[model samples]
Target: MGCLSEESPSRSMKPFVFTWNGALALIVKVSIQPCVTLFSHPKEMASSSSSSSSSSDIGVILNELTCPVCSELYKEPTALPCGHSFCRVCIEKSWENREEDTGYVCLNCREIFAQKPKLKKNVIVANLVENMKLKEGKVWLEVEVQDTEHGDVNVKEAMKSGGSESFCELCNGEAAKRCVPCDILCCEKHLKPHQQKGHKLVDPGVKIEELRCIEHGKPILLYCKDDESLMCVTCTGGEHQDHKIVGVEIAHAELKDVLAAKYPHVSQSMQSVASQLRQVQKEEEKTENSSRDAEDSLEEKGRLVCQFVNESVDLMKSEINKRKMEKLSLLGKQREKLEQQMEDLRQRKSTMDTALQDLEAISFLQDSKDLLKRLETMSDFKSVKRTPLPVLDFSKEENNLDGLIMLNKNFLEKIQKGPVEHPEKVAEGPVEHPEKVELDQNNLRRLYGRSPSLDPNSAHRRIKISRDLRTATRTGTENQYRKHPDRFDDFLQVVSRDCFSSGRHYWEVDVRSSRRWVIGICSNSMGRKGVESGLGGNPESWCLFKGNNEFTAHHNSRATDLSLPGDPKRFGFFLDCEVGELTCFGDSRVLHVFWGNSMDPVKPAIGVYDGSVHFVHLVK
Candidate 1:
């Protein structure tokens, strides 16, 4: 208060006149006339002084005024025709609706100004407004002190300063308003806007609850079969509505129980089946091994059988060849003997013819008469002293015969001269010669002139049997003949019973019950005849049995016979049977038949002995 001061304009007031100094000065004189009355009166001057002082204070205030639009003190205050002093933003907003052609209208007077108005600085009014704001701050503080002392710290203070008016937080208003539920204070204009628009508040809280649809906002309530997932109600009604749906908690409980009950039995069944499969596989392996072994054994046996059969056939063929060689050797010896005999007969016949020719020539000579008279004069030819007449000396003829006989003896000696030795062994004792007996010449001549009956003993000499002939029997019948007196015409006649002939001969034997007979061609004459011998039990005896239906031959322990069903007419010399066939050599005069109940009729028996017959079975 003490610093306040004012200047008086009344004391200095004075009147003044203007005079024209030049043509331009005349306009200045007229311009000063309006200002003359303001300084004429003392009372008017005092009032002017007070107004001047106030104007000066307003200038100071305006210098401190901060505009709400630009936030600075006003330099050139443009007052609208409304007389309000404001910055351009505040004034423009207040008059912005006025038409451009009419220019801005005043907010205070609601006056429309037609011209664009120019603003000038108002220092006094600006200073007043600044001073008031400072004073309000000081007073507001003092009221806050009083409220604190009274224990009312929450209370709002009264306004004592000058500035822009207080505004609501929601709507920016000056009237008092507050929310009791949220415990927030605001202006009256903003209270309803806060409740309805700013805060998300609703009655019953139901609309607020539905706003948050996140999964964590609630527990899962449904199962989605498509994805097999647990989902909330919002997801179920939206994305999973058509899928198979169930309560999540119920599905979980049922699935857990089923898995727990069935696992153990299924595992056991799988293990058992695996074991059985293993057993079957092992058995199959064993069976394969056994089959292989059996095949190997069968192959081995077949090889052995083939080897045995081959060896047996070779041995039999060897035996047959040996027998054939022996027969051929015997035939060679017989032919040599016959040739020698023929040579001896031819020489004897030539000598006899030459002697008969000599006798005929002597009878024809009649010239020796004196020799004949001497023979006639002697009364006894034997007693006459006579010179011997040369009878054709037959003694010389006998000497020629004797020479031939000596040559024959020498040949026989050559044949018998070698050691009397068996082929396989040597005899220990000296070989004995059989006794030599002479035949009567008269009996020999009778025998030589005719076919003589056989004598057993003499025939035995001609038909010499070999010791190798294993079976032979001799009959007792023998007939003997006397040789005739003429030595050249001697023969023997002998009759004998049937006996086994020696050398090699083809023989067929037939047996009927205990009887045996033999039919064969002798090797010497190739004769065909049947000779009955005896039974076949003795080791050194054999026979041939001849019957109407059956024929058999026995030698050693072996017996051969025509089979019961054999053909009789076709079976003769050079016949052979082996296996199931019968064959004959030479003419087809031999036959064989086999009619067994168990045999094949067409196959019967095998026969191949035109030269030789062999039986063989070839096994592969």
Candidate 2:
């Protein structure tokens, strides 16, 4: 019985024990299952998580590291030996900033770098950075899940219940519906297309890598003209033959540098030229001012000289008037004295005529007495005695009367001549005639008798008014002062006192060394037939020979004589000779000839009023 009863309880305890062991085993299995599975896929899980986390960290780092120069994510980043990475432009700018220094210092590493840094390109790094940035901006869809009071709705079920939609972040295209099963947002058109066509989509967390030239792999731009090929140094010469290829960063940098370098020089040169132009303008202004001042000074001096000359002319006119008044007074006094002398001569002539008539009557009575004596002796004797008695006293009175008549006649003749020599001298002389009561018979007859009567017709008659005298009288007043003014008189006085009309009546001097010759004729017109007959009528006619040697005979007579020590050729006469000398110094192989009405050898005529003629011989 006991054995049977123990078996029954054991069976029931066994069911309970099995249930407890199963429960513990499930817990153990749940904990240890994870450990066992972790070992089996350890490398795979670690690799997946590390890659995802590294990618996320890398995206954050790249987003933070922007190029300072271009203010963008590094497109073509280059790594320096100092462990710092920068866009090519950022490094180049830092390098240029220290151009005056020995070297550049890295902004990140604080390391002194070479002045010419090795600007190596890291295309792989640049591409990775670009891919990370693209992944951050990838388009995605968002669907909101509605939770009910019962519980949170199933995302997949919600999408299946018309919650699925599509959205494009690039163009802001939003989904209007949701796919419950796919848990995607989609519009009406995209919903069908995404489900049916299974469109390829980029993961929002994935990044795109930056592309570089396939040939060079150095982040340079490929020139389209070069067949769209990338070029390294080798390709640059071969595949890129004549390509318009460029290192993108360097091309842009060079453009900026060129503009900066050239502008300043051009601006400085323009400023320098402008300053020089201003200086020149200032100098010109000063020079013009000086010229104006000089012109004004010259004008002032000219005016002063003109004023002085006008004042001098006025003084000369005043002096001339004073001299004219003095000359008129002297002429008036001389006219008065001449009239008185003429009256005195007329009174003496009348007395002489009366005395001559008395003598004639006495002579007639004596002739009658002789005739009557023969007829009647007694009557004739009485008449003859009466006439003799008158004659006896008639001789004394007749002699006195005859002397007075002769004296009166001579005084009258002197009065007829122009004005008497000196009125003062005549007034001082005795006016009364000499009283001779008993004149000698011979003296009385000599005084009364006339020497002879002048013949009315004479062979060599005196010229009443010759042509030369008439011409001199006609123009005398107008030309008198001009021909011999006080100035000319002074000049003549000096010349005449110092020089003589070289007695060489007609002489010519050949001053060849002085290129001149002087010929002259001296004349004195004091004789009966003077120099006026030989050398024209005036003394100045001799001056006609002053120029050249050509002579002409006109009116009365003409002659010419030329003498030379040597012969001459091609002779000509010059008519204008105002100044300077005439020379005959030329080749001596010629002759000058002349002929006139008179062939008489020129004789030297000498007189007090002689003039000279001169001839000038000019040398060739």
Candidate 3:
């Protein structure tokens, strides 16, 4: 705490100040207090220099170079005509502090200049101070000892971790720190010169290679965006001219933002996938439990059905087991696909974790490209679905074969509802229903009416099909249709139940009470939206149109006005697919004939406007 002992090691090392322009460059060699000395008399300095000078003698000479005014090492030392010297800037400071500039007596000679002495660097003294400091540094630097607290420096691990210091290159011995500007390691003994200005010292634990540019051998202080590589200042103009470069800290901050912005999307995806996996796990568990419950229920109920029918119990069990085997076979295939997808997702999760753990900026972004592409295939990974297992259908009363099971009309329903009550008594022969739809007097209704039901699923949302499904009415307001790839979203046309490819088919649409109507056969590939969707006008449609008592038949969007005598109450539409021919009759008289080339099956379609049109089917 007080002045160090005169015999202390600090006395051997003195301040060696060098001026770069006018800066007072000081290199401190002592770990404790500095033994900076005041300027002494000539005889005292002579006595101090009496000893035989060695390589370390520069220390004594440098100590004597301290400024007479400031009592510190010479910094920008200047001389007056009186043969006395002081630091140029220090003398001015002294004059200002004492407010004695006009009497400006030299601190050593007590002689005043006519005015303030012109201040110029004492070049000779500056050079001597620098050369002596260099000698002194080399002499003392050869004797420094390493601190024992930390273990031997690891150059390799230090390089990998990135900082500054490691082992010295000269002797392969441990060092205390690294000089960044030199990009070299120095032991405590050879580190003094590196501790001065124009050099940067960093902790010895840092890696040398990571901080220096490989080509220029300079510290990587900036990032080069054009090359996606780290670089040094010299790289911007030399190798990467015109390329985008930013400070390493700035680039790191921006790239961190780029990665952070994707976090929400990645987190949501993980949550969604995890939820789906949990659902699959629950489904597997439910299936296992369901199988056990089903076996128990069937065993209980099989006894009742077998006893009542007087059938061999073993035969009935064999049939049930056969059906169960068939269903299990299907479920097995589905499960195989599901498990494969699950394994794939697991692998993707592992890849994601590895990518996240990689701290290297280059590698992390590079690996993410492949990861993103892999994610594309996972968008449709659902394959665990299985059809509901079949159960005994008891809806067919009295013809039940106790020893066998058949997939019947309500087989799916029974699975959902549990087995229906066993039929009252399995009847011996099948009962026939004599009920039939009445035909026209000419036996024509059977040909035209498969009960021409409009498919509501395919109709536009604005259209309201009748309860019996024979009529389609459109509300005037144009509205959006339910989303479907096949449904017409822009037009008002409805399709029928069946198509005929090679038969001559006849049907009658009665539009006597309608203001505007269309009856036609539409190709299966007709466009459902836009101008091309209109009945009788599109290339895929042919229709007979009635508007304001005018009749016209259109094919390929071109209309041919029919010269009928009057509006026909019922228009007879006939299509012969084998010849690609269509004919229409008004009042039983041939009115028009349209020809098409393809022999593909076609469905009859109808559209109405302003009033309703009826599909003329016979009632008994």
Against the true structure, whose TM-score is highest?
3
Q: Judged by lDDT against the true structure, how good is candidate 2? A: 0.33
Residues 462-483, candidate 2: write the lDDT tens digits. Answer: 1111222110011112222322
Candidate 2 least-lDDT 10 residues = 27-36
Instruction: Quote the positional error of residue 360 for candidate 3 in Å.
Output: 99
Ranking by TM-score: 3, 2, 1
RMSD to truth, every model: 46.4, 36.9, 35.4
Instruction: State candidate 2's TM-score.
Output: 0.24
TM-score list, all predictions: 0.21, 0.24, 0.28
| Candidate 2: segments with Cα more than 4 A from true spot | 1-63, 68-71, 75-78, 87-296, 334-620
What are the per-residue Cα lDDT tens digits for candidate 1 across 1-620?
Answer: 11122341111222211122210100100011110111113444344433322111211222224332222344344555555555665455434422334445443233556765775556564443333332222221111111222232211222212112343222233635333222223454334433432222223212322433356343243456568876544465466656655544445665677777777878888889888889888888988988899689759865874775566557655755766676667666766666665666565556545444655545524423544454344443222233333333345334434543553454356458853233124211111321121222222222211111122232222122123221122223322323422111111111122222211112222111112223221112111122211123222222333444455544333456533344332222211111211122111222222111112111111111011111111111
Among these predictions, the greatest lDDT belongs to: 3
Per-prediction backbone clash count:
50, 30, 7
How well is each residue in 1-620 modelled by candidate 3, as lDDT tens digits? Answer: 12222342322344322222222223323212132122223453355433212222232333345553333456777877765567776566444423322456565545666576677777766654554343334322221212133343332333234332355643344767776644456677556654432245677777767777799665565677778898765566566766665556557988999989998999999999999999999999999999989788768766765674465445566766787898788888888888898898887788778778999999888888888887776645666666787775533322234112332222344458754332222221111321221112132333332345676666776766777877777667754656776677766668876677764567777776677878888887778888778887766787888777787877766777777677678876666554466656666556766667644568878776766666666441
Better of 1 and 3 by lDDT: 3
Write down the worst ten-residue block by lDDT for model 3.
Answer: 430-439
Q: State how far residue 595 of model 2 sits from its true place (Å).
A: 46
Residue 341 of model 3, lDDT score: 87
